[model samples]
Target: MKKIFVVALGIMLCTGISNLQAQNDNSETPNFSKLDASPMDLALYRNQENEPMARIIYSRPQKREREVFGKLVPYGEVWRTGANEATELTLYEDMKVAGETVPKGTYTLYTIPEEKEWTVILNKKTHTWGAYEYASEEDFVRINVPVRKAPNNIEALSMAFEQVEDGANLLIGWDDRYIKVPFKESM
Candidate 1:
């Protein structure tokens, strides 16, 4: 009985060590940001409102001297919009994005890059790791926005919400091109 107990103890220790080694081998540091768009635009611009109406969470990836638009990201292909996990957009209230009504909720953001235009898609699926699981049939809204010329190169993928006359503009930029998706607050 004592021999069997000793063998079991040794096995447990070996398994624990193996687990520790595996963890160490895969140890990685990922910087994530809970980008609050509500305070940036909704709170500051809309004086009558006290709550944040929209937000996004995503990881930033830098361009290390590589071709971005047509090559690295590949034009005409769906991009996850950021690094690591899929970029998420959270809306606290209903809004009209490029004439399509988007109900208030969390959504996975995706984009298809083109030379002169871009397709922005809002999917019902949330917490997706990447665009690998993206399905066109599941798209809530596929809005085509014109690509604008940026003055300077943007090293990282970024989205900025700016106040517009009727509502707000979600500007996505990377490298030297950008696109603005206008949205109006509803409900």
Candidate 2:
């Protein structure tokens, strides 16, 4: 009886120690950075049925009381569209942009800001860090859209879809200016 009890006690003690050792190894804290200055955001365009038609993933940079266009973001230069990384646009279906039909796929969104208008570009390259390596040959579509003044100052770079009769307008606002890029449903 004593021998049996002693063996059982040894087995339980060994099992408990191993379990504790495994727990300690797995409980080590992971090294992570603090929050990003320019946080990431998502904008989705949905149909009347609440089905998502398209989505945009980008980062928002604050104006911070600085001149945005023609100064901080120079004119006639291909901007990543926002800070951090190049903007990512995913199309769920075939759509018309600037009178040209674009197929469904993911693409990097770039832009050239001007005083009167802005040229929006959809490039085949995705997961790009910035426009430093922007290739004009890889552009899938490019459209020139007129810029408009926002009613109020937009502290942060913002993007949203405004649903219209035929489709939706991608509204981008920053500082005191805004622009609309129309996306019409294809037949």
Candidate 3:
């Protein structure tokens, strides 16, 4: 009886340990940092009452002297729009994205980069690792934005929301290139 009890306890302990390991498996590296190794960043825009109106969470990959468009990211393809996990966009209120109305919700952001223009894609899928499994049919809206050259080179990828007259323009920038996607509160 004592031997059987001991064996069962050992099995339970191993199973518990396995569950804990699985929980910790998916996460950022324990501890890593450097300029070339830009980590994940979160950008949030708030209203006058300090309520978050919009939020973006994405990873920034450094230039590292590599060609950004048509090479590393590959033009005419659906890029994750950032490093690591798929970029996330959360809206607190209904808004007009490039003339199309989008209700307040969280969505994944993707892009198809081109020399003259870039197509900004907002999809309903969230919590994705990358754009590897992106589906165009799942897209909420595709906004065509003109690409513009940056005055100076940017090493790390970046996204910012600048306050516009009524809402904000989401600025996506990297490697001397950028595009702005305007979003206005729905009337």
Q: Which residue pairs show backbone clashes in model 3?
A: none
Ranking by TM-score: 2, 3, 1
Off by over 4 Å in 2: 1-28
Q: Candidate 3's residue-wise lDDT over 1-187, tens digit each?
A: 9999999999999999988887677573364445546589988877656777899999999899999899999989999999889999999999889889999999999999999999999999889988888998899999899999989998999989988877889999999999999988777
Candidate 2 residues 69-148, lDDT tens each?
99999999999999999999999989899889999999999999999999999999999997987999999999999999
lDDT of each: 0.79, 0.93, 0.90
Identify the candidate with maximal TM-score. 2
**Best by lDDT, which number?**
2
- State the displacement of the C-alpha of residue 129, model 1, in Å, after optimal TM-score superposition: 1.0
Return the candidate ranking by lDDT, descending: 2, 3, 1
The reply for model 1, stretches above 4 Å from the true place, is 1-50
TM per candidate: 0.73, 0.84, 0.79
| lDDT per residue as tens, model 1, 103-186 | 989889899989998999999988888799999888999988899989999887777778776677887888888898777887
